[model samples]
Target: MISLLFGAGASFGAELHKPVPPLGNYLFDKLVELGGAFAELPDDIKQEFRLHGFEKGMLSIPNDSRVINPLQKEIAKYLSSFKPSNENAYVRLFRSLREYAKHVNVITLNYDLLIEHAMLMSGAQKVSYGIDANEKSYSVLKVHGSANFVPVLAPNIIFEGNVSIGCGAFIETNQIRSLNSHEEIIKWCDSRQNSDLSPIMCMYNKEKRVVINPKYLESKRKDYTGVISNTRTLIIVGVKYIEHDNHIWDVILDSAPELIIVDPYPSEEFLLLLKQRNITHTLIRDSFYKSVLKLSLHIRSRVKIDPQI
Candidate 1:
């Protein structure tokens, strides 16, 4: 089986227009561009983001800060606006994988829905998350949650204590199962008066903590392991192998599949890590846009040589 993993770089390459979503380092800038709540953030907070990365910087702040809610919501709103061109790299890659539909599994750490859009454009029947599927569907697992995965706040159910203990908000996985339309996402984001919902953005720390329900996260992890374990060829596009994401790295190292990493400039640290692990991998020193085209051609050539493959 073949598995595909994508990161922020993949989304950046798939942008249909200018101001391609900034990477983690430039996140604060993007948030600033959005103005409103983000604009009100103190200079120290912005400096912290610049000094440390997004995850570490976010972790420095208290979890219950008022800014957290608006931060998550604005991020979702900004990312939702990103649309991939009809014939983008993701579409080309999906088209190449069409022949091996059942044997393929896709996992993305990005919050954008570009993958879904591209899959549809590539003639995929449906996009399934985790274990849920139809025979024609392709599994598109989002390990770092998604722009559409909104947390639903539970009603006030406080226990009688010295300090009012109340039930916290949680994500309804069932709600995600039923979110089959763009209208549903619009409703969630556009509900200005309703503070009951908030977007579940990407990872901000090593603990993998989020305000949403834990079951949903567990489901994603289980599905990720199942895919990686069986992956013969793991095609990674635009992902940075950072220390904070060791959980993801642990699975890849344990599986130790043949790796194909696509990026313009592969990091030396990443190359060294792969070497230290004694895992065989190919580095495609090109942008995802160009690399995916090459990948598609390679796939086509292989099929022509042996149709049975």
Candidate 2:
């Protein structure tokens, strides 16, 4: 099976119209510019952050409890605020994938719903999360979580501490976040008073998207782990390797499939790491949309050469 793993960079073209950079960088840059306790963070953290550059500053903020909630909101808003363009080649790009690679799946590290919106806009029969399926269409396994996802309450389950929504609850994908058919989710969430009803957004492996879960829940991981392990070709877009995402890194190393990385500014350190691990990868030094278009052209040519394919 083919898997598409996207990072914040995947949404750069869409978010640029918002007049800011990708969601993660915008938040991190804002926080950094604020110049308070955030600026006073350890030198070790700051030093490591310098290696990844601005776009990756989001990774530095995830573990720090003070910024997780704000980070989540910024990510969600940046994602939901932007509507996918009919003219966007990515919509066509993904549509082609669904048509060509019937068994394709998407694993996004981003909290944004851009992929979901694009798929829905392209008239997909179903855009499922994790194990849930319509069987007729594609699935997206959000390793972090989604902005529209909601918590599933369990009455019999008992938990005493750190329940962001309510005790004994787990997150489930909400089919819709917009109140109107044409309204965007960011607008919908902004107008709503009860933001808690929305799924919590965070970076860790947990049920809540809003905070770091110490529980390390297995059910939370089962679907993504299963999907990733079987990935024959993994297309990674705009991700800078970071320590917080070690689990994701583990999967990538273990899968070690045909790798395609999309980033205009690729990391040399990351390239060295990949080389050390002996993982073969094709580095596409272009923006997400353009790189996808290039790959799409190659696939189209192959399809033409073999009519049976």
Q: On a 0 to 1 TM-score scale, where does candidate 2 land against the true structure?
A: 0.67
- Tens digits of per-residue lDDT for model 1, 1-309: 667789888877764454466788887777787676667778887777779877777766555424555567677767766666755788878877676666556889887778887877778788877634333676688987887776544445221111211323333434443244455666765675335345665446656666554567667777788888887778888898876676688889888998889888777987898899999898888878778767665445433333433
Q: Write the per-residue lDDT of candidate 2 for residues 201-255, one digit (tens) a residue.
A: 5542222333423232234456667777887667777776774556677877777
Worst 10 residues of 1 by lDDT: 158-167
Q: Model 1 segments beyond 4 Å from truth? A: 15-19, 131-135, 151-186, 192-194, 297-309
Determine the backbone clash count of candidate 2.
5
TM-score of 1: 0.84
Best by TM-score: 1
